[model samples]
Target chain A: GAGVSQSPRYKVAKRGQDVALRCDPISGHVSLFWYQQALGQGPEFLTYFQNEAQLDKSGLPSDRFFAERPEGSVSTLKIQRTQQEDSAVYLCASSLALWERVYEQYFGPGTRLTVT
Target chain B: AQSVSQHNHHVILSEAASLELGCNYSYGGTVNLFWYVQYPGQHLQLLLKYFSGDPLVKGIKGFEAEFIKSKFSFNLRKPSVQWSDTAEYFCAVNAHYGGSQGNLIFGKGTKLSVKP
Candidate 1:
């Protein structure tokens, strides 16, 4: 079975530009998550979605970052006015359920975003 | 706010050497713990998790972790490591919020370099 996958393995954006990163979660998965990983650091949670409903967006750093998962499928993280500090790897993960006693997230290869 | 801590930022060991990585979380509530590994140029994969039942849990590739509630720790250990074990390891915790599992809070990660 195909695992979670992200598109545009690498992306370079100029400061103040807008960029979008896409994620395709595993088929039948009901939960999706986004994370940001800086170089030499761990991934920080960005947002979470259950089916087509956005459950958590508290992890998003600022108003410039926004995400949506319409139709209960593919998701996209869009950053408006990219900043140099936004240079990091954007990771996407998915799980089979939302309220399982234990949720094991399957991660994608991640899209490395560079803002210059 | 809950946070995870990985004591070792980097570790170097020869093949067949024993390995142990320390992880501690700051949340006092019931939490689900996880360990993830990311090989070079690869996505993160689950190594093990501790939800309940046992304190010591075994995972893939002969990996195991011990969850100590009193100590707030979930440390990963391997009896003998191989060259292929070289990768970055992450410790994460998701606290149960409002009777539902929440997003994971990750540590800074530990980079292991195993020499054959």
Candidate 2:
């Protein structure tokens, strides 16, 4: 009965560097999502995965952002050539199933990425 | 793209005061509404959600939200708030479209400060 978990609670990266944030969803969760939250702002959608398939990436701000869920369990969000504008809290969430009529999402503590 | 609005940017109240946080969405179709709370140093937690059926939905920690379709609103309320309830409250909406996976659109958030 673990909730979603993210790694590197705080990351400081230089501009143009690349960083990969990791997420571990709860056991048996089939859906995972990533979001970005600026200071004093609510989180915005980034990408979503259903099992092993990356179903939604439209929310990705740019091509530099990429995500993958290889085995339908763990996921990673890689930001290539990070910019100062990309500095924010990266959040991950998971739900039991994707097709359920109603499912509540459990959130992670989030990784605070700071592009200096 | 759907958008969520939280009218109150910040609120200050004494313990045991009645609490009401307003939220509105711009999408005109069937939507799933949610209220998430983020404590000082914690992850975002679901306060409540409204998918269908009863317009009034209750959630954990003595929180509730009412969905009013006529006004495109889903406002969160609590009979009495405690100092522990001081946190950032976010309103989100996931519009049900054709064959689309649910992705949340969140508001700017309301910062509530409850003085004990």
Candidate 2 clash figure, as a count: 0
Per-model TM-score, in order, reads 0.98, 0.97
Q: Give one digit per residue, the lDDT tens place, for model 1 in B1-97.
A: 8889999999999999999999999999888899999999999999999888999999999999999999999999999999999999999998887
The weakest ten consecutive residues by lDDT in model 1 chain A span A95-104
Off by over 4 Å in 1: none
Residue pairs that clash (backbone atoms under 3 angstroms), model 1? none
* Segments of candidate 2 deviating more than 4 angstroms: none
Candidate 2 CAPRI category: medium
Candidate 2 colliding pairs = none
Judge the docking of candidate 1 as incorrect, acceptable, medium or high: medium
- In order, the interface RMSDs are 1.4, 1.6
